[model samples]
Every structure is written in C-alpha cells, then in structure tokens.
Target: MTSSNFPKAERLLRRPEFLQFNEGASKLHTQYFLVLLKRNEGTGTRVGFTASKKVGNAVVRNSIKRRLREFYRQNKSLFISADINIVAKKGADVLDFHQISTELAAAFGRLRKKYA
Candidate 1:
C-alpha cells in the first residue's frame, strides 16, 4: 500500500487557526471546490478541509474531503509553504475522482504566481 505522507500535525483543526487563514487569503475557484490559501509560518505546507451543509450529508462531505486529501498527497511538488483550506462547493458531492483531481490541479496552477 502506498501510505500517505501527510502529517496529521500539519492539519488545521482549531477554529482560531481556520479563522486566521480566512483573513487575507487568496482564493481559487473551480466547479467543484473553492481553495483558500494563505502563506504559512510553518516550514512545510498545511491544509484543512471544509464542506458545508449545502454540499451534502455526512457521507458526501467525507467523500469530498477524501478526494481533496488524495489530490494533495499526490501533488506535493506543486505546493508552497501555505495553509490551504478546501471547501466543497455545490455539486461537488457527485464529482468523479478524475474531475476532482483536474479542478485541484487547475487551482494549484492558478495559485502558482501568487505563491511566488
């Protein structure tokens, strides 16, 4: 099995952490998700995932979160030092894995200039 290398400690868990990222964050929008990003103090990249009630029920939300995590895991070379929060938008719950990955890749590309 190819285990994910993502560190649990790098995840934004507390409300205050997420709140901090909310202010002055650069955003990338796609059909399936909205990616909000802020340059981070930490050495490596950190991330968080959120899906509102509008997205779907618990099962659907978890599915989106899983897809987001998988995208991040595979695309480490594209990242900068940042705190990223990905929020599932309407219709995201129904997206296939390839669709989700495509949107995520596009979002990362869009943020490249900003991160530099």
Candidate 2:
C-alpha cells in the first residue's frame, strides 16, 4: 500500500521551482481551483498549493490550503509523477472539505485520463 505520509520531498517549496514548473505546465481549470500540471522525470510526484490574498484573509487562505493538502495527502495515488500546483480561486474558501474533495477528484480524474 502507498504510505499516507506527506514527506518534504513530495512538495514544491521554493519560488524558483514554481516559476520553472509554470513555464512548461499544462493547466486544468475547475470551478474553485486552477491546477497546473507538468510531467517530471523524477520518481515521485510533487505538489504545491497557492491561495492568494484575493481568495481571502490569511485565515481563510490557510484554511483553503489546509483542505487542499488534506485532499492530496489522502489521494496521492491518484496522481502521476508530475509537479502539480493547485491554486485556489476567489470563492474556494467557501467550500467544505467534502466539496473540495469532490471537485479535486474530478480534476484529478481528468488529469489521469490525459496522462495515462
């Protein structure tokens, strides 16, 4: 079974990495998010979450990010070996965990079909 732990190696943590990844990524747009996907030759997938000030105040932004991280952590197997950046839309802070999960699942399903 795939481990549930979200290790540091599985995250995009720096500005340069995000910028470089964005340069070559293909985008997937959902109702409450914008997912940027780029294939990587690395052995594991890496993900990053972004919630700009436009989304809400610090509290709301962090909540959105936490929800995104939880969804990714629980569904890591659904992703391929790629660098993915999930950016929250303005109203995403309004979603509950289940709603976020449902939307993200559909987005990832499309991603899998495309990259599979």
Candidate 3:
C-alpha cells in the first residue's frame, strides 16, 4: 500500500498544544485556522480539513473538504512538517474551487516563507 501523505500525528490534534495562527494566518476571510509546525518529529506535513454543519448539507461540506484536500495534496511540498486544521467559515461553501485554491495556495505559501 502507498504511504499516506497526511498522517495523523500528535502535533495536529493533541490537546494542550493548540497553536493558532495570528490574524494574518487566516487570509481572504475571517475563517480562523490553527497551525502547529515542527522541524523533525513527524513523517511529513499532514493536514486535516474540517467543515461544520453550518456550511450546508453533506454535499456542500464534503465538497469543501475535497477542495481543501486537493489543494494541500497537490501542493504538499509548499507546506512545512506540521499538522494543520482548516476550519470553514460562512462563505466557504459559496466559493468555487479555483477561488479556494488560490487563497489556500497563497496562505500556504506564507507558511512556507516562514520556514525559508
């Protein structure tokens, strides 16, 4: 079996280690996100995409998750070795994949710049 790029390590979801990004971490919208990055602990940069019921029905929520996953998977190298949780906001569902991808890419690029 192929190894999973998005591994569920302790840094991503463990309690007591929550490190949310500043207002700048979240861009293009008010949707807040938490990023926990480390140098050498996990295998690779794993990410989790979340969308609550407030967004819409199951279809809409899954769509958002799919877009986020695609955005991260396609551009995995752009991110550092950490666990990331992407929370969805009100306008998330209404936005298209291309739009979301652009925002996500820019946001992720910022993260990469921090390490570089």
**Best TM-score among the predictions, by candidate number:** 2
TM-score of 1: 0.89
Question: What C-alpha lDDT values do all the predictions have?
Answer: 0.83, 0.92, 0.62
lDDT of 3 at 33: 35
Candidate number with the higher lDDT (2 or 3): 2
What TM-score do all the candidates reach, one by one?
0.89, 0.95, 0.66
Q: Number of clashing pairs, model 1?
A: 0
Return whichever of 1 and 3 wins on TM-score.
1
- In order of lDDT, best first, we have 2, 1, 3
lDDT for 36 in candidate 3 is 37
Clashing pairs in 1: none
Which regions in candidate 3 have their CA more than 4 angstroms from the true location? 1-40
Better of 2 and 3 by TM-score: 2
Question: How do these models rank on TM-score, best leading?
Answer: 2, 1, 3
Q: Global lDDT for candidate 3?
A: 0.62
Please give the distance, in angstroms, between residue 103's alpha carbon in candidate 2 and its true position after superposition. Answer: 0.3
All-Cα superposition RMSD per candidate: 2.0, 1.5, 4.7
Clashes of each: 0, 0, 0
